[model samples]
Structure formats: structure tokens, C-alpha cells
Target: MTAGASYHGQPVIKAPVWTWQIPWYFFTGGVAGASAGLGYLCELRGDDALARRAWAAAMAGICVSPALLIADLGRPQRFLNMLRMFKVTSPMSVGTWILQGSAASTAIAAAHAWFGLFPRLARVAAPAAALLGLPLSTYTAALVTNTAVPVWHEARRTLPFVFGAGAGLSAGAAALIGADPATAAPARRLALGGAAMELATTTLMHRGLGEHGRPYSQGRCKHFDQAASGFLAVGSALLAARGSRSRTAAAAGGVLLLAGAVSTRWSVFAAGRQSAADPHAVIDPQRAGIARGERIGGARTEPVARDAAAPAGPAS
Candidate 1:
């Protein structure tokens, strides 16, 4: 154990204030962003039926996402206040605008695709939505990682990919519902690829986190992680084997993938909170850096002795 590391054995950082809604928002935002991109790809391929379904799913996700975010803030006005100014340096600021743009662009594209209105606008909006979707889908990873949280900051390299994969999995799964065999192939491929990538990236994140990954591997977070992996694995297998031929199989696989997406977000969020609640999660890493003779914040790691002239404080 490092000397002078503990402060009454208490956590140095406060746990995140975000609640259940944030994870749901993350899941839905990812779905909305990925679905828009998938829809545009389907449109380019002249698969209007599949494109419409993807856009519709994007619309549904974007619509639900804001409500979840607003609910988390505990006031619609607080959410609106975020739109008052844009800060390129702030992940939260950029993410808020991305969500807003995604909501509008997706709604417009879905309307045109579904109701056959404003073809010219959709031609412009569809590709725009797809472009914005890339950032929208993965920006939440930046938001969480920008904080002092050990688990999130340490796994920053791969968490975006994890979130992106979860988004693709959920979006593709949603599109697979009620789609015919011929038109469902693309969605099935998307879902399968997403599930595989999600599993791989999540593993990579945990491995990369090293000692800081305990929150992900132990206790309640471990269960969430296991559920995510199991669901993605089973769902992908089911989709790969029979999804193309059977609508029922496709729908079932899609449902599992959606569940996996939710579990992925929940696991990541919970792990970050758990890490924050554990003081050692912060201290040990710094101590390890000091042991390596690394300078932290340009300050020497050597302990400083108290001055002889200093006055003593009363004990608590």
C-alpha cells in the first residue's frame, strides 16, 4: 500500500448523480444514431422498405432519448438550458447539440420515407443525419470518460466502440422486426456484426482497464457484464443460423440484442459509479505511477515533511 494514500479511507470523488434514465438515454441515443446511418445505407441500395423501417426506428429512438435525458435532469427547463450556448470544449455541450440535430434530421427523414413527403428535403437530410449519427452514437463515451472516474477514464480507448456496437445492435434488431426475409438480410447482418463487435470491444475494454477494471469484473457489475455477453452471443448465433430465413427467429434474435445493448450501457455506468465509490480506485493508480518515478501533475511524489513552526489543529 502507498503511504499517505488514504484520507480516512474515504472516497476522494463523489459518485455520479446520473440515474437509471442516463443508461436508457445512452441506449436510445445510440440506437437513433446508428439507425439513421443504416437507413441511409439501405436507401442507397434502393431498399426503400428496409430504409423506411430503419428510419422509423431511428425516429422512435430519438424521440424517446430526449425524454429520458430530460427525466434524468428532473426538469425540462434544465435540458433546454443546455441549448442556450454551444461549447466545443465541452462533451456535454457537443452531445446536447448532436442529440438535438439527430432528433430533427431523423424525424424529417423518417417522415419522408414513411409518408412520401418532401423528397428533396429527405435527399439532403438523410445523408446529413447519417453523418451526425456517427458522433451522436459514440459521444456519450466521451462524456463519461472526460470525468475523473477511474474505470471510465482508463477504458476510454475502447468504450466508444462498445457503445457504437451496442447502438448498431439495437438499431438493427429494431429494424428486423416484421421485415420479410429478403429485405431483412441487411438488418440481420448489421445485428450480427454489432453483437460480435460489442462482445469483442467490451472484452478489450476490461482487459485494457487492468487493475481499474475490478468494478466491471466483480459484484453486481459482473452480473450485468455477464448478461450482456451471454445475450449478445446467443442473439448473434441465433441470427446467424436462421435469421435470414425465419421472421420469428430474426425478431427473437433482435430482442435479445436489444437487451444486450441495455445491459452493456448499464454495466459500464454501474462500474464507473462503483469505481468512484471506492477510494482505492483513485489512490492505487496514482501510487503505481509514483512508484514508477513518474511525475504526477508536474509535482514530486516524495512526501514533504511538516514545518517545525506550523501550528497544530484540534483533533476531530
Candidate 2:
């Protein structure tokens, strides 16, 4: 099938209705989740100051996350309504609870570290928040892949890792914004590690996507993807060279890392939208499957037509 071939040349699927707020929500939610997880690890290592800053970063990200989600939803109540169910099969339902639990636990942990409150609750909440953070960082990948969007669905296996890397990068960058060079050492390491992982996983994801990945490399979508990679690379380089010795370098690198992470989310979201809008994104994949003798939708490769005037044959 050619690109122009479809049901009368219309899109095979509707483009997503999501807007700018969704990408922002993804970025912040990722930062919150990664920060919580990193904070717990730092606490276990007895790096109290670094852990405190991490919790604070988690608090800040969580605060922005819900507001962005609510804005996208057009109402605060709609966000709350998602928590009404805990369906195991639904990514959105599971993610909603993860966000809620992460927010509450981070808040408790942050309060204890910053204001000296809730000492007993903080111990349990801290670990709980860290545990929830892993899914919270990458569940958006599952949510999008669960849909019919060709680009997203094709990259499902690696998207979570890419998202997790972005989360770590952004959280580390946010943490680097404050504190001395010595205190920011761990954050720098996290950011650099995330940048490397993101670069590797993203390359593999695009390679695995084959023709379905066109949106990420063509038109305006290409620019966003390039910017994401560029920012992360430059940020990581700067951090490695001077982040441990200079606060100024660390802060600037941190800003670039955040920009890179945000751009990564935006590029992925835009690519999915573009793929959904293109008919060939859906048609070409199925046609290839048919060529490979793979049954589509568990049905036969050839269409079966019945004659209304003739007697119907018995079921096989």
C-alpha cells in the first residue's frame, strides 16, 4: 500500500486531542517520580542534605504535575474521577493512583526533612513513594502504547526506558539548580547517566520502529527530536567537564538538561499525533504483516464474501 491509500484517503485513526499541557505534565510527573526514587537512595546512603533537596525537588514537580493534568482535563473533578476505579488492566487508572500516592508520600517526606514534621510517618512514606516512583516515571509510555497510534504502539518495548531516562535527567537537573558543587555531585552523575541511556534507548527505539518512525525524523517533528538530543548531549558534556568544580556550570547544565527532557516528551507526543494523522502509518504495517503471513486481528488474510441469495454454508 502507498501513503495516499486508505479508506478514501482519510486518516486511519483520529489525531489525539491532547494539547501542550500534556507534555508539560509528562515532564513534571517524570521529574517527581525520579526525584522521589533518587531521594530515597540518597537517604539510605546518609547523604541527608542531598536527600532533602531531592525530596524538595519531588514536591515541586508533583505540585506542577497535577495542575497541568487538571488544566488538560478542563476540570479538577475529572482528575479526581479517575481515582474512582483501580482496574488492573487500565494504565490510566493505575497511573492515577501512582501519582496520588507519590504526591502524598513525597509531601510527607519533604515536610519531615524541611520543616521537621511527621517524623514517624516519613519513614514509611519515603519508601512507599520510592516504590511508586518507578511506575510513575514510565507508566505514560504504557498508557500511550495501549492506544492504536502506530508510532507509540510500535515503540512500546523501549519507550518506558526512554521515559525513565528522561525522568532521571530532569530530576537530576532540577536538583542541581541549587546547592554547592560538592553537594550537586550525585545529581550531576544522575543527569549524565540519564543522558547516555536516553541517547542509546532512543536510537534503538527508532531503529526498531522501521517505517512507522518517520514522524520523528521528518518535518517539524524532526526539529523537536534533534533539539532533545542536542540539549541532552551538550548538557551532559558541560556537567561532566565542570559541574563538580563550579556552581555556575552546574546550574547552566541543569537548565539545558531540563529543556532537553521537556523537548523529548514533546517530540514523542508530536510524533504520535503525526503518525495517527497519517493513513499509511496504519495501512503499511498491516500490509507488511499480511505479506509475512501474519493474520491480522486473528482473521483470515483473504476477505470472505457470502451470497445473500444462496443458502449459507454450515460453519466449519
**TM-scores for all predictions:** 0.92, 0.92
| Whole-model lDDT per candidate | 0.89, 0.88
User: Which numbered prediction scores highest in lDDT against the true structure?
Assistant: 1
Model 2 C-alpha lDDT versus the unseen true structure: 0.88
- Model 2 stretches astray by more than 4 angstroms: 74-76, 296-316
lDDT of 2 by residue, 121-236 (tens): 99999998888888999999998888999999999999999999999988888889866889777888899999888889988999999888999988767888999999998998
lDDT of 1 by residue, 60-141 (tens): 8899988888888856676779988999878999999998888888888999999988889888889989989989999999
Model 1 TM: 0.92
Best by TM-score: 2
